[model samples]
Target chain A: MSSLIVASIYQQVINDVIHNIQRDFEDSGVDVSVLNELQQLWETKIIQSRVTNFPPEDDKNQLEQEEDMENSSKRGTNKQKAKARSKSYNQNLSVGNINQDESEDELSDANSVVSNKYPENETKFTGQSAASLASIINTSNTNNMSANTGYPLSPSQRKNNAFEEDYDDQNSSTDDESQNQPLSTRAPQFLASGVNAPLASMSPMMGQRNLDQAQQNSSKINDLLNNNATGNDYMYQSLGSNSLANNNSQDTKKPYLPQNDGCDDPISVWKIFLAERKLKQLNSANKLDSTEQNKDFNMTISQVDGDNSENGGDITEHMVLCQYDKVSRTKNKWKCVLKDGIMLVNGRNYLFHKANGDFEW
Target chain B: MSQYYELYRTSTLGFALTDSLDELIQAGHITPQLAIRVLMQYDKSIAEALTNHVKARATIKGSLKTYRFCDDVWTFIISNPNFKFENEVVSADKVKIVACNARRPDEA
Candidate 1:
């Protein structure tokens, strides 16, 4: 009776942990597709470890019985659905050995739980992918079984041994009564079992690390989708589809263009203000054609450039230095001014894009 | 104060959100989980606002409550999408390497 209670509790805890992990991934912006991959990876690890760790035939038989009963009941509705399918479809769906219905059913149970949890946006595992994943899991499990039965442990299996040690430490410290019981009385040890005890305490750290990795992977995928966007260039790619679409149409309407004249030379604020004023005036006049306005705009920018060339260089330099000093003083920091009209950020000079207020370096 | 706190103070929106959080913390309603969620929400809002060209003050309604923040300077702040609230100031080359989805000059 005590053993049955312990087993039930363990199963409940596993379900809770799986649910929590799903929630954690969802909150971290991991979509259904990636979540599916993560779940598969975790389940694979659990199965592989179980194959190696559980040696006694009695324990294996009991576990298989429990898993079979649970999976069949869960898949009870699906069995009828499967009956209507053609033999070829059933063969395709049954990726594992036909005799090992219990394990296959257990695998499907895990997959179905994830799908059922997110009915609205779940990414279901297709037959082909599920088959391939099952095959991979089987091969890994066989390797683990061989390592346990015949040869010394592989490096990864050694890690699993370490995990078992940690699990023993945790289990012994927490449940002294359970420690006295025979190992065969316990439930089949899976990868998640060892990790679950530490999960509550370590979840924040683990979740954060996993979230960071997932975010990086997704960002890389996004970049690849965007024609291998190079260096601050992906920003423009994503922004172009939305807010910039309007700007693009406006650009087509107006023949006026902003040109990058020199890398070092900074456009005076006054020049931009003057240009804005002239453009506004020309827009209001409604008499000048686009080509004409474009000509006027270019002439105005060049004329401002020419006029500034006389004293604009020195004055702008002085103004930038003063602004830099003001910022530095406010922040209680000292920074060296550089040759280019760059803004000092964290005590370093970086070229500033006045139009969008970005670093141009 | 973290670098993000400093950066937030530079704008009205950042100030408003920070102030609101301060008020919540003082009120004893803010947990660590809540704080992290709020921070993530703030970052997402900034990114979304930048993409949508919301160049004015906007109100964001989170799961907890609604708060208003200035977005006028978001275009400048969002020049790098790789920025997170937890990130420190990186070098210019690293910044340049961050793919910017900012509107092109033609589009702008």
Candidate 2:
């Protein structure tokens, strides 16, 4: 059986971190609710990952009840607050469970409803001054969901709309309509307005040459966009070919190479950064493919070789985190005393207070 | 403030916490600065917890595939290792050992 100590170890770590950071939270002037949300999110993530088995819910509740009973007199208010938090958390989980079979859109909608109701739940728990806390709690809940679901695009788009409204009051009516349009259609207008704002602020004495340059830059941007569209489609095909072909294509697609000469110009600098980022992404993707192929080839070779020598193959995934009491080596042999270690083997995690290791290099 | 090694952040538990923190940051729930503070707290907490709370003992034997000592840290790659726990023996084809100095840098 796997070691049962991991659950308590993790629990103790969470408690320690929360306890230690309480003062820091207060010092930073962030609401306590965010801290509680952090703890809740951490626990939910750990439980979801299933890296190690935790006790069943009934047993866990029993343990918490026992602890509550023992400390009820000293920390009664804290216990009550914890109870409220857990109750709300359970409701959130139940909502998710009930909507699990629904479409993703419906599930997200249900989550939003629960998020809206969260402030009322907090109000009931806190009694006074909850009206002020309601908005923060609501945003926290929505943001928490966005984090959990791994789809932050919608929230960011909403933020961009809010930003646009704040900056462009005259265009607010058009902004409301644009918000309903697809991002591709909306983005160009946003960029155009952004460009026009600075130009309008500049004095005419800045010269027609500057205006002409701006027009030239806009044309160059259009060319870059067209290049990007074709480059992306080619990238999809390049994944099947070798890295050399990808590099050759990257070299040939240098229409904007002249801009790199103007290193002092901010626009050119930004363009260089963007180009480098795209190149890095492409190179990293190719590296991932090669590494994956190497891994597969190594696995096949290992299988064929069949345990011929102890040190014949690459290191597998097993790992140990510990402190050494002493490490002594003689010739090619090695010995060490490892203390307070967590060992991960196969898929299970084990904790050891002391470990004696004997090995030959 | 005592300094602790951030190496354990690569472990499974630390990786889980880091992933959670990343999600929170991406959602704009917490700032990257706050996440760094939380991770620092985690490093101290787990190190202390492991030292003071853990009580199990084990013995392992293997052939050391590679060993390196640098900047007061030990990295050992052991092949075909067998771990003898209290009740059972577990074996792995290979295991990497990351051992930080038992003494804190401040103390040293």
Candidate 3:
């Protein structure tokens, strides 16, 4: 009785899907025979899995007819009727699967077009910055030369020119320094440049021979330089601490080395370090190889486990898919009202309209 | 639009249909999009057929090992479960129950 019900439920599902997707198949320009083939393949697979005993072929036709009547009775809703009409109209002008590929290609082309704009915009932005920097430098140089030759420039004007030159120097030095340090180390340099900008402007005031102001500015510059030095020291300290941790680990492992044989010679110590590094590399490589082999072994085991049952595995096999009408629990006892469920138990499939489950946790 | 849950796709029947659809796709007899539409139809049809056609009722008793309620889905792992139908009783060492809410998402 259970097998028969399951078989009939499966039959109904397959028939309903096939009937519903006829328009989709037509629109896709796939031959109707392919859909028939899919149906046959699906049925054969289900039978092979032996989830349930299907009725004889003659009985199948009777079951299908009965299901068809039931479906027809329930499928008279206006929404589906409207959908059917629309599908019929679309069938006349359906462009088929070829158009689908073309549409995908067009979508990719659009994405590529959008992606191509990004690099061009980045280049334009960089070019504008470079041009503006060059202009600033040129104007400052011309103004300084004109002031020196024609007349004495005001302190503020000299200060502005000095600040510009300092900024240009910082920019060029930073570009060069960037090549030697990681990006994280550049943060302190930017802070240093920001602190130096105002002090750099004051340097020209010292050149004007205001003795007291010159001394004050020099002291301020010294303090700023000290602060900049501390910032750099902190950055370097973080990097050094990381390296120190690594060295400590290496030192702990160093006892394994032959300490009695030429341990005092610098060359011997360097050679030992090189050999240890090579051994570590080889060990890591071997570990990676073993991990890969383990992965392959696991894959084979899982594949064998999957082959043990055609229904994927025990997890998928002994499972239930259902809707819960009501689920309530009190203390350790649990109860549920499950409806419209498909239960795969002990390699056999069962269909139930409603299931009452009482369990203790 | 009424949408059906894809929870049943892990069932043997749905798995077989998906395997066959995959084969059709691999053979270039049908596109992936068409296969997806077929699956969508399958979801709707199966949900409807199970609700309207089958009338079998079952009573199950077990010791629940683990129970979880997440995202409106109730999952229960039961040990030594016994399922009793009209005249037949099926027993399994362990069974997993994955139950979605009866009320549709849109309805909720």
The best candidate by lDDT is 3
True contacts kept of 1: 0.00
Lowest summed lDDT across 10 adjacent residues in model 2 chain A is found at A96-105
Better structure of 2 and 3 per lDDT = 3
lDDT of 1 by residue, A71-130 (tens): 545443322222222132333322111111221222233333322211111011111112
What 10-residue stretch in candidate 1 chain A is worst by lDDT?
A119-128
Models 1 onward score TM values of: 0.17, 0.52, 0.47
True contacts kept of each: 0.00, 0.55, 0.64
Better of 1 and 3 by TM-score: 3
DockQ for all models? 0.04, 0.37, 0.25
| CAPRI level of candidate 1 | incorrect
For model 3 chain A, where is the 10-residue window of minimal lDDT? A147-156
Please, what are the lDDT tens digits per residue for candidate 3 over residues A76-168? 221133223224433431211111111112212222332222221111111111222222333323211111111010111111121222222
Clashing pairs in 2: A353-B56
lDDT of 2 at A284: 28
Instruction: TM-score winner between 1 and 2, please give it.
Output: 2
Name every residue pair that clashes in candidate 3: none
Q: Which candidate do you rate higher for TM-score, 2 or 3? A: 2
